[model samples]
Target: MAHIKSRKHPAARRLNCSAAVALAFIALPGAIHAQQTKPASAKAATEATLPEVNVQGQAQSYKSDQVSSPKFTQPLVDTPQTISIIKKEVFQEQGATTLTDALRNTPGVTMLIGEGGNSSARGNISMRGFDTAGSIFVDGMRDLGNFPRDIYNTEQIEVIKGPSGSEYGRGAPSGTVNMSSKTPFAGNLNAGSLSAGTDKQKRATVDLNRKLNESSAFRINAMAQDSGIPGRDVAKNKGWALAPSFAFGLNTPTRIFLNLEHIEQRNRPDFGVPTVGLPGYYNAALAAKGIVPPSKVNPKNFYGSTSDFENVNGDMVTARIEHDIRPGTILRNTTRIAKVQHEWMATAPSGAVSDGSGSAAVARPDPNTWTANRSRQTKWQKNELITNQTNLTTEFKTGSIAHTLSTGVEFIYEKQLSKTIAGAGTMSPANLWNPNPSDPISGYALTPNGAQSKGDTMTVSLYAFDTLKLSEQWQLSGGVRFDRYSTENNNVMVDGVRTRLKSSDTLAGWKLGALYKPASNGSIYASVSTSQQPPGGSNFTLSATDTNINNPNLEPQKATNVEVGTKWDVLDNKLAVTAAVYRSENTNDLTTRGADPGQIIQYGKKRVSGVELGVVGNITNQWAVSAGLAKMNTKVVAGSATQTGSSLNWSPELTFTAWTTYKLASGLTIGGGARYVDGMVRSVSNTANAATTNMLNVPSYWVYDAVASYNVNQNLALRLNLYNLFDKEYVASLNNNGNRYTPGGARAALLTANLKF
Candidate 1:
């Protein structure tokens, strides 16, 4: 949940469910033979048998045929819903070092400019018209904290869109993002990368694997980086991380795995620039009297001083065991413990330049000596978590029907502690146009005052999924899950009074799907799914006030999704094409009172309907491509005036993403891609189509990136990445309040040397 702060910077969290997956691979041969059973006399005689099965050719590296989760019984093409996966090779080739950067490969997802420090949510994000900040997972477990995520130790990232409460215990109504970790395997090798680039970007990484024996292996990965944002002054990122994993019984029926991770980050967080001149920008001070139109400030200006900083420490330990009970059955158990601590002090710039004494608040007013007043924000937070999961997967036959079933039980405990630092006094204003990072900032907040909070959640979950192959061309799938959770909260107000609240409930969710095969390599499917989100289930905070949505007494919000789609593999099984038309409807159980004043309502509804198309894999042996496009229609079926409209805040109507690469026979490769986001409305101070005193809508923009690499030898290569190739200037994202916005990256380059042994 949002309240938990990690102990430090985040590192790789892998080997989640690895032990069981490895055991299944080792038992594959026996599984095929276990299906046979006969009387001794009949078995001895020459008898009928199943035909041998053989699969030829390898899938392209840019495409993934299957997902890491055990719940899905079919390949990505045969599955009923849409799933977007970004493999390590893809992001690495693009020089995408963070989770946000890598996610650009997928459409229908948008990032949010986070709110103020006093907010409980961190690293806000939206997908399919819903907030998904709390639905990010690592190795099948929730990953806490709202900060930039590194990808050095990640294998792949999978985005499962739509209501999937039956797949995971609790999550956002939109969807979930799961990151698979890299674990030790039966291999021996060493590899790494060293890079230096513009904006003082310098980075180094190392990966080493050692084989202890035929059945055991150990691996470790480490990364260090020091970088600054292009076109932005004083904003920096510095971090180091290490992940180590050990595996035993790689070829046996039973396997064991242990994984550990740690990371430290000392960074200067960006607060973004003032949105004073963007289209739709409105200012109360000037709107009534019609003062000089505001002047556009430089997007590169640094609004924060050198004292602004964000320090993080994150650590995790995981242990797992898996056993092959029979040729067709697997039993797996995994346990993990993680701790994270985060703290930050930063400045938030607001409004046009003001001299703090009544001078006309305008950019470069008179002699351009005007200064902008900035608000100081500070917080300290920590998060602690532990979880245990056990699962069973088996294949069986009931008369003429064949089935694959997966069942699991899980236990979790999580806690978050947060403290707000009170400012000692007001901060001196800084020059609006030419802000100086060296400007001395005094009276900043350092120590915590009376404002504090502590939240805890405990959960027990049971889930089962089954797929029935009715015939060669027909399949039916269904899943059910129940979660019994308890939450408690403690808050201390500014007056030093502590208040405690607790809530408990049981939530149920289910999904159903059917598939029909038109040919050997194509399928058409239809599905229905449902999910629920309880009050405080995402943010981890409970309220006693009757009007607050997080009040424990409120009922859980509900969501339902309906979809029809088709998938196919073409071009000699080297390429995949998919299309889906779907609708998702969510009904929020209000706080016994409507969001609008002087009104009451039991339920409010919202809907998002869209069509999505995707293509991935290879057009030829030498060329690879991954692309997706989505057109969405969002509407507030019933809600407050500000929230009821055809367009939801931050939800764009159309988005597209594509990346392609062609390999040359000379050991050289080159690729480039473009992304587009439609203009988004700001619903905070204005209606869906009306204007306000601030930027009512963010302008649509397109950005381009390219990469090229040349192999010097079998073990060494040189690579270069160019970003924002056209140097497009646009707003990347804006805060919900519409006062601040982050600028898109300017033209930049990075040169790297890759090594392997």
Candidate 2:
């Protein structure tokens, strides 16, 4: 949990690729491009117009070579980092609907329930041993909400690994997740899908694109879904979304785009099953009473009353303009405004229940007659974001060296408002063993106490990047970014008193990379990058306590990463193979290891090192595949192992995922994939340190999924997906306290008819 304030470390003070192996390999035809040394007729003018990084298209439908962000300025094979790019086609083939479903194609990522005292952060997650819910982005701009994101309008997803402050502003040390929206393309096309499956699942999606003229196009995407958990009772997910975009002067030197999206959701929230007889259950009070731990409750049990609900709304608008200054030079500007609103109410079980009076420590000897201590979570909040960005990309040669450069400036304004609520209001406890939704003594209503809080932030950032082709086989790339920002917080506490807090700071970050092309389609590379997190950077709320990490007076946390890797495109450029080894070190964590309680120090440090391997694209013209594996170790190198933030609390030692499909040339295709997550210890360090929790670990698990499709005609197809093919019972996610868990889905099936014209 340490943050390095400077861009350079002691040994790293001196420094900083093959074609990348991380993401699917498509191609980026625009932006900074490398200039060719050959004759002008040999893609020369375009080379000078292209960035130093490059790629070829066709053959492999499962691979993409470049990211949506122009900041990269190079193809994945040449970039020295661990990245995962998932295209809509991949997930669509698997019948995936939500962001969570799509992310299963990668390794080193895990889900999270909320902390002990907070409600669940529905779509929250942990990656590479750090919380990353706050680092989600869309089309290069930050998405402020933690709500579950739908992929109906998305073209592809990019999972950028390691600290990446040079690419984005203040962010999670673990990395960032970015989604690229589907936009207008030439030609008239209409596509849609209708699906039905287990748990009464029903869903539909539509995508339409029209070319009005040679210079204009229009597109729209829409989706609706209603589904229920296979094993859990009284839990369901229902939502709808629409995204529309228009483009003008697409083939001209100047082009403009207007886009917007809106989504609505209503769902039944599940707090999860209790942990009494699970692994590592040791309760002193119960043991002293000569009572043994009772049998674990069924994973299908639902603790919340039937009245529980979660409602959410998300909206976004974007405007973009792009101009070609010259054959190889392009300038672009983009602006966006977005907002998300969330409200929820749910019930959770704590321990043994007491008389309606709510007394303390009530333990019942009769396991069957025991009652659960019911607690309610109610929330109402809104998150807003506004941002503008401008960039210039151009390629040129200086002597024998060719260069692709990109520079940009950005402005952002973000806001959050929260309403405080207290008290469960006449709600009664449910039976410990089997709770009934109808057995409620309800006199309950959504009521907000006289308390509220708001946070606002304004920021401006400037950045520049350049990729240099030193020779036919050597390349160097680097970038630097500076961000200036200010934040303010206002609160109206329960006491009817108001308090105001403010913070201002500047953050500087950068990265360097070097690549040596062993072959035209392959490379070996190395890279170093840094990320910074200022006070209140994640939530935008400064704290009054000097010892708190969010205190305005505290220094920004800094994280540095070092990585080495190789990438190769083989079998006539149809298949890609990649491997990398990396170490991310965060220094200067705030801790009172040897100091007084109120006086914190910044000498603590934590580190996560790992190896990653990936393969994507077609093994043969008729066969496509994608797969990844990650192995990591997290440790509190220089702090109290049990201290919060000193080490990762939910990092798994190993994770693996894989998928493949083959077309039989008879209009039929078959594919299947597997996912494995190693046991996640709830302790700070990877060492043998026991965390303070009844459930010390979430056991490792494996899940398999299968898919098959038939192309009935040129514009029609039928696809079927089988999830949890073996119906293996396991834990999907666990809360911070480890006393509750979300169970993995039971075996289920989904059928869909795809249409296009």
- Top candidate, metric TM-score: 2
Model 1 stretches with alpha carbons more than 4 Å out: 1-60, 116-122, 292-294, 353-370, 589-596, 684-692
Query: lDDT value for candidate 1?
Result: 0.79
**Where's the lowest-lDDT run of ten residues in candidate 2?**
9-18
lDDT of 2 by residue, 1-757 (tens): 3222222223001000112423333231111013223332454466567775333222237888899998888888788788899988799998888888898898999988775222364577789988888888899899886777889999999999999899898988899999999999778989999999988889999999999999999999999988887788789989999999999998899999999999999988888877766665544445545677667778788887788888889999999999999988899999999999988888776545222222223345778776666677788789999999999999999999999999999999999988876654545666778877666645576678989889999999999999999987899999999999999989899989998999898899899999988556677899999999988888877777755777776778889999998887666456778888999988767754643333356676778998888888887777899888887888777775346434467788788888999887686888899998888777564344232225667888889999988889879999999999999988888876666778888899999999998
The residue-by-residue lDDT of candidate 1 on 551-637, one tens digit each, is 787777888999998777666456777778899998863512233243544366888898777777887777888888777888877
Instruction: Tell me the alpha-carbon RMSD of every candidate.
Output: 9.1, 6.5
Model 2: how large is the Cα RMSD against the reference?
6.5
Per-prediction tally of clashes: 16, 28
Whole-model Cα lDDT of every candidate shown, in order: 0.79, 0.80
| Candidate whose lDDT is highest | 2
Q: What's the distance in Å from true for residue 583, model 1?
A: 0.6
